[model samples]
Target: MPKLARTIRFDESDAQVFSRPAEAGEWAIPGGFEFSNWTEGDLSGKARQAFANGWLSLESFGRATLVAVAQVEEAELEPLARRLADHFVQLYGAPDAEAALPIAREEIAYMVELCADHSPNVLLAVSRELTEAGVRESFRAITPAEAEIDLVAIHGSAD
Candidate 1:
């Protein structure tokens, strides 16, 4: 089994704050690549909210304010990697799927590492800031009591 991050939503705020809100329970990653070229001015409004603390969902290319650690079966890995590779080709303009596959797998592997130390249902949030080097990201875990996430029901799948 592999552990990975899944999008979680508590209210409509995520929908309102993000240009495109990630669907609850979809596989997600820190996804700093989305803001790699952004300048200070671009980091305002909803976009800034996203840059400040959003996990990028692979399914919709949308943002989520929080993510929960979840266990994924080994069988799911290949398809997830392929889907991310396709995203690289379509969204990030990778030359081709063949060229993107390795990077996709690496990203997914990193997500697995991120979730490995946490138990299932452990909520995580990100904070980001752009520096001269590029986008820098930090993560913090929120307990269920602190987030009141037990009140929210997360559904769907990585699919």
Candidate 2:
């Protein structure tokens, strides 16, 4: 295969793309395809750049879909990231990254919404000491344990 501009990819194992944009927003699914809330300046150029690089389109639910893989070649990933970042600044404007200590933190929330079904649960926590010390290892790490919640729903029951 020829060298691609960006290593755009998606997993077949993952759930199908949700049908509605609002559904994706509610779930906080990362817009791995493009920037958000684009402004009038340079955003079109940025989107164009990404398309030139290697933005792949998948047909699902009569709409185009986008996704990316991290394992892409550096030549592709770098340009793709740069263009997409520019596009983000256009849409979302400036970052108001919550900051503390030595770190100027930026956060992105990703939520995958499963239609009429439940996805797996996730536990999130951060150590104060680690955060204060500017350590990132703990930020992205996950530790899951036996847990309980009230999300269960009863079906085909009469009360």
Candidate 3:
């Protein structure tokens, strides 16, 4: 099984900060293509927040601040690739999906490789910026603490 990144949200801030916040649990990719034509002036307000730390959601085509590593079935790849290709044609103005398919596959593959070494449930965040050379991106991994319950967990008892 290949590992993949999925969006995760701990609070409402993602909704407040991003122009379009990705739904929780949506599949994600680095999505640097969105910023390929951007310059420093484009980095302002929510756009700046997105550039600083956002992963692109595959389903909503929205932005996420963090993603969790998850296992992916091999069968899911082709459909996802097709969806990405369609998105390229529709949004990025690719001549056609056939012409965009290869690039979509490569982008998905890159995200799969990025998650492969990390265990499931590990969180990943990305930071991006444009410099004189070009767009630059960096990533960081955060491992969840080893605990059976989180701070907001609930308990139930029955008689």
Best-fitting candidate, scored by lDDT: 3
TM-score against truth, every candidate: 0.89, 0.23, 0.90
Q: State residue 122's C-alpha deviation in candidate 2, in Å.
A: 21
Clashes within 3 Å, all models in order = 0, 3, 0
Looking at model 3, report the run of 10 residues with the lowest lDDT sum.
146-155
Q: Which stretches of candidate 3 lie over 4 Å from their true place?
A: 146-159
Choose 1 or 3, whichever is better by TM-score: 3
Worst 10 residues of 2 by lDDT: 101-110
Off by over 4 Å in 1: 145-159
Candidate 3 Cα lDDT to native = 0.90
Rank the candidate models, highest lDDT first.
Answer: 3, 1, 2
lDDT tens readout by residue for model 3, 9-128: 876778999999999999999999889998888999999998888899999999999899999999998888899999999999999999999999999999999999999999898988
lDDT on C-alpha atoms for all candidate structures: 0.89, 0.25, 0.90
